[model samples]
Target: MNTFCLEVSGPFACFTRPEMKVERVSYDVITPSAARSVFEAILWKPQIRWRITRIEVLNPIRWINLRRNEVGAVVSTRNVQQAMNAGSGYLGLDIEDERQQRAGLFLRDAAYRLHAELALSPKANDPLVKYAEMFSRRATKGQCVNQPYLGCREFAADFRLVAASAAERPAIDETRDLGWMLHDLDFTYPCAPQPRFFRAEMKNGVILVPDFETGEVKS
Candidate 1:
């Protein structure tokens, strides 16, 4: 299996904590789910999926607070279905009326080096090289299907392909147990997303991800 290396960074990021009820609070580092989303933004296919192996934190973690206005309620699905059925129904949210002020604790000046491998889905028939070459070309040319975001859609992320030789960038020297971090969500049920977690330990600024499917921790 070929491992792809990428360096993604942004001014602000919020991998929102699941425990937070209202105000947005971010994790110390990027979540694996968010990391996977970044790669999918660059190149994605139904035949293959990304599995993050490791994350190297290059910059020291920092935080900044911000208060912003956003809508509180979503347009009900019933309203959307009605709109589709009637050709024209109320499918819009009155932003002015639903607007509420919320505070967010977000990361600032964040940067990380991510390593991931592609896992072939049951639908895959093409060789691995085909997908590897496709990803290399797109990453080299900075081509993406859609703009990649750090955590929220508003905070855009910048990325680049890191050559194998240049992939030796050193991570900061730090060690801490981050408790149980949300690895990703199980989307088996399209409507109801289930959260998954694993014990996260950042040693020497590097977080080693486990095989999420097998429940085996990496040594």
Candidate 2:
């Protein structure tokens, strides 16, 4: 496997639980998909995909409550399609009319070390090392297609390539059973929502993430 690691940290994060229909509740630790997103931010290619293997919590998990403003209604694709079909060529959502306040339980001062590997698609022609080196070089130089966020884009995350020596440092001395958490989404169409969950346990501050193909993830 072509493997690499990154150290990611953020002031706040909210990996919203699927069960929370009303209020947002964050997972005890970052999810595999979220970790993959950090890597995707640095570099992404259609020929390669990321698989998060493990996560190390460098700082103690701290919880904080917040009430954030959000829009209750959104302009969906159907709305845009309808507008285009009618030749109106215009659509708008008044935030003031749809604005809502929601509570969220988020993690504060969160930091994690991500370990992941790449899987080259059948169409890929180059060796895995080439892409691995590309990612490492991009990360080291602080290059990214977009700014990586922890969970919410408002809570931005800072990430960098880990050094071989400093990478060996252990995570915070702690352990806990985090219960079933969202593993990843199975998008039926263009990033549509279909969530999967898995039993989460943190041992010595390290969380083991399952591969997407594993039976551990439940719909």
Best by lDDT: 1
Candidate 2: residue pairs that collide:
none
RMSD values for the candidates in order, in angstroms, are: 2.2, 1.9
Reference-based TM-score of each model? 0.95, 0.92
- lDDT per residue (tens digit) for residues 92-148 in model 1: 888999999999999999999999998778899998889988998999999998988
> What residue pairs are clashing in model 1?
none
Q: Name the best candidate (by TM-score).
A: 1
- Residue 16 lDDT in candidate 1: 96
lDDT of 2 by residue, 1-219 (tens): 388888999999999887789999998889988998999999899889888999999999899999999989878898899988998855788999999999999999999999998889788999888898899889999999999999999999998888672636789999899998888888756667788888989999989998877899898
Query: In model 1, which regions exceed 4 Å deviation?
Result: 165-168, 216-219
lDDT of each: 0.90, 0.89
